[model samples]
Target: MAFIANMLMAVYQTNISDLFEVVDYLLMLKAPSFKSVYKWRLEQEHKLRERIHAESNKTENSHVMTDTEVWDFIQYFQRITEECLSEMPARANFLYELDDSRKIKFRLSNL
Candidate 1:
């Protein structure tokens, strides 16, 4: 579970490229000891990625995220962070406030 916390810290405080390292760390958590938890996290991450990709491809003239999409993204991250924190509260306390920063950067870069 410490691994989950590490991954959340990386996600909350790092750039997208840097977050890739978090993904790698997550993969490490996929071992049998943590398989169920890791699988749940993977599903949540996959959904979040799908939503982000869809929003990113929208055209300015006719692009908008539904409330559901917004909700999904917010919930996705919340769940992820919560799960990590639950497993390792200490690491959650160390997260940098980079979540919004990374989100904005992703938006701009995609544009």
Candidate 2:
């Protein structure tokens, strides 16, 4: 929740008009289930796009994404998440097969 609030703060700092909406969205974000939060996020994304379009048009800077672009983003994000999940066991097994010393060495190698 704090992370989300921080991100939203950055956004609202750029456009004060969005502060109220961000506050309201954060309030609805207190749901106890992932499904509920996902639903709200989708709905809020569309609403935000529309709001941005309307606001941008007033400034002669229309920068709304096409439907295909939105769909592609959604698809790619889900695909990446699924791919990461599918690779999780293989990743875990790689570490599990290593001895303690090698595991520490491998971890430190990344650093």
Candidate 3:
């Protein structure tokens, strides 16, 4: 979960909007039970986007994504990571046979 939060923070700092969506999608794919929170978070994201669009209109220079977009994305990512990690087991033995290299590769590829 800490790793997830750190990666999400990095994504926000990089201004990679797609990664925010991807993380949400990945969490949903990993656990169908988290669908409700995922959808709620998506709605929150849209609201944040709308707010950013509105705020940018007041500026002389037009902007694509406002600070609110990054802030909200970071908040949602943190919340979702916390919720998801709380539900998942500390460690699953299903992949015990695979070496760490293969496991990390599979995890990244899956995301």
Q: Residue-wise lDDT of candidate 2 within 1-111, one digit each (tens)? A: 569657765785678655444553221112223333344456666676778767665523444445555555565345334544354334332322223222322321111
What are the lDDT figures for the candidates, one per model? 0.45, 0.44, 0.47
Residues 1-111, model 3: lDDT tens digits = 679779877876577556454453332223323344355555665676677768775533444345456456556555655664464323322211223222322232322
- lDDT for 102 in candidate 2 is 24
Give residue 94's lDDT in candidate 2 (0 to 100).
Answer: 34
TM-score of 3: 0.26
Clashes of 1: 0
Give me the candidate number with maximum TM-score: 2
Model 3: worst 10 consecutive residues (lDDT sum): 93-102
Candidate 1 lDDT over 7-94, as tens digits, reads: 8768766775565556522211111223333445556656766676687764444434454555554554565545553554232323
How does candidate 2 score on lDDT? 0.44
